[model samples]
Target: MSDQNVAARTRAALDAGEGILRLAPTWVPRSFLMPGARLKLSREDLYALGTHRGGIDERWFSSTTPAANEGAPPDEGLSYVVHDGAKFTLRDAVGAHADELIGPALNAKYKRWPVYSKFFDNLGPIPHHMHQSQEQAEKIGLEGKPESYYFPPQLNWTGNNFPYTFMGLEPGTTKEQVRRCLEDWNKGDNGILDLSKAYRLKPGTGWLVPPDVLHAPGSLVTYEPQWGSDVFGMYQSLVEGRRVPWELLVKDVPKEYHQDLDYLVEQLDWEQNVDPEFKANHYLEPIVRTGSEQEGFVDKWIVYGTVAGKQVFSACELTVLPGRSVTIKDPGAYGLVVVQGSGHIGKLDVDSPNFIRFGEVTKDEVFVTHKRAGEGVTFKNTGSEPFVSLRYFGPDAHSDLPKVGDYLKVG
Candidate 1:
């Protein structure tokens, strides 16, 4: 379609829903991981993209950033906006109407939506890996990824194989130990995880992970709000008896430094990785947004805190009581996903589905334009259960937000 046509359609979508756009579910696969099957996708459709391509283990929300998986389609991780029985990519909508969609300040700066959220469900655990820092990724002309995780109780009814995540290096871990693990890559089980500590996964909790920090996420349905980049390097040689190719360890490294053990080890943020207060600094608990539960709804900050001292991204879990309604005003644009019950968000009907088929559109996802968010959107719960949804905002969305250690003061 022409750029003019996209712009026209984008405008129509914004107007039709009063700045709220319903989005189609965007499923993403990972060749290295097994699906936990808690994403509401039908079991038969887990391998809908083919077993070789891995299972549909992730569902991205309001994303423009494509998945970095090898052998994936061009639109693998991009979301589609459904309006008037027509569908168009959210990427193109942002491209054609950036100012109207994301706000003039963010559009002028990033020129695109700078962040995306996803539900990544795995059966066991991911390989110990680290996303490149901006300095490291820029060497390959790519961007960094700083992500935060929130496990929602509604989706995490069952914690699969392993309900614990290994994050960062132990306080006294040495670089030589890590280097030795890398050298033993060809051997079965490189034992990189031995140098780390695992925390029991808990639903209704979260963690802020900086770029270049190693992590092996456990089996739980995770709601992640992250920077719009997919650059990472796996340090573990094997995961759950599955071999992790050497190429994956150097996937985002410069070609010249691919085999440089020192360079690979240097990629880690030593100070942060070895911080003794890792959990105290990175772990997050929901903080009520200066309100009481007696109100009609509860708004909690599920994912907050800065990345590199900047408000890179943030998220909130809003739960409207049955038969109640609330109007919320945010500072910027956000992508939303309904996780429980059914409700009316502005003009769009939102519902959490029991099962979603491959290539099917769902009412559970939507995007609220910056203008609409600032003006306020009313949510009405029409179901007997609590209506729950998650909304993630882009960088610098709020002038004042909860800090990393703020949850400690909650009580």
Candidate 2:
């Protein structure tokens, strides 16, 4: 399609929704992972993409970046904005209206929506893996990803297989030990987890994970807000009796260093991996925004903290009492997902979906433009239960952003 056509449709969407655009669910599948069946996607549609493509385990929100899954369609992970029975990819909308949609500052620096959030529900634990840092990703013409996770209490009713994550290596672990694990990749079960300590995953909490950190995430439906990049390298040799290919370990590494054990070992951020106080540095708990608890609504910062000292992303959980309403203002645009109850957000209807079929449209998700956010949007809880929503922002969106351990300081 031509730029003129996209721009026209984008403008029409913005005008129709009063600066907020409803988004279609963007489901993604991972060939190696088992779906936890908690994302509200209908059981009949879990394998809608065909079993060969694996189960639909993830649902991305307000995304402009496509999934890097091999053989995936070009628009696999991209979100589409729906209006007046017509739709266009959010990527096209942002490309046509970057300044007004995402804001001028972000558009000037990133030239696109640089961050996105997703709900990834896995049955067991993911293999130990690490995302390349920007310095390393630059080698492959992609950006580094720094992600944060929040395990929503509503979605995680049951911990499927394992409810503990192995994050970073034990403080006394040696580089040679890790090198040996890689050398033993061809052997069954490389035993990388033996060198790391596991933390019991808890609901209503989160963690800030920077690039180059090794993590084997546990069985929980995680709400992740992160930089817009899909670059990662799995380090574990086997998971759940399934042998992980060696190609996955060096997929993001340069072609020349694919077989170089030492170079591959150097990919890890050694100091971080060996940090004794890893939890103290990365664990996060919801911090109530000061003065945000009014008679009808309350807001809590669910995801916050800087990545490499830069405010790359943040998220908030807003709960409105039934029969009440609240108006909120923010510094920038955001992507929102309604998790519980029914409500009205500005000019759009919002409801937490119970079960969604593949290729179905939902009122649970929307993108609020920067202008509408700054002007303030009113949300009303029209259901019998409390209306709950989760919204995530782009870089530098919060001037008073909370730190990792700020919740402890709250009285």
Candidate 2 lDDT over 287-395, as tens digits, reads 9873344587889999999988999999999999989999999999999999999999998889998989999999999999999999999999999998999999999
Off by over 4 Å in 1: none
RMSD of each: 0.8, 1.0
- What's model 1's overall lDDT? 0.94
lDDT of 1 by residue, 1-411 (tens): 888988899999999999999999999999989999999999999999999999999999999999999999899899998888788999999998888789999999999998999999999999999999999999999999999999999999999999999999999999999999999999889999999999999999999999999999999999999999999999999899999999999989999999999999999999999999999889999998834558889999999999889899999999999999999999999999999999999988889999899999889999999999999999999999999999999999988789988988867
What are the per-model numbers of colliding residue pairs?
0, 0
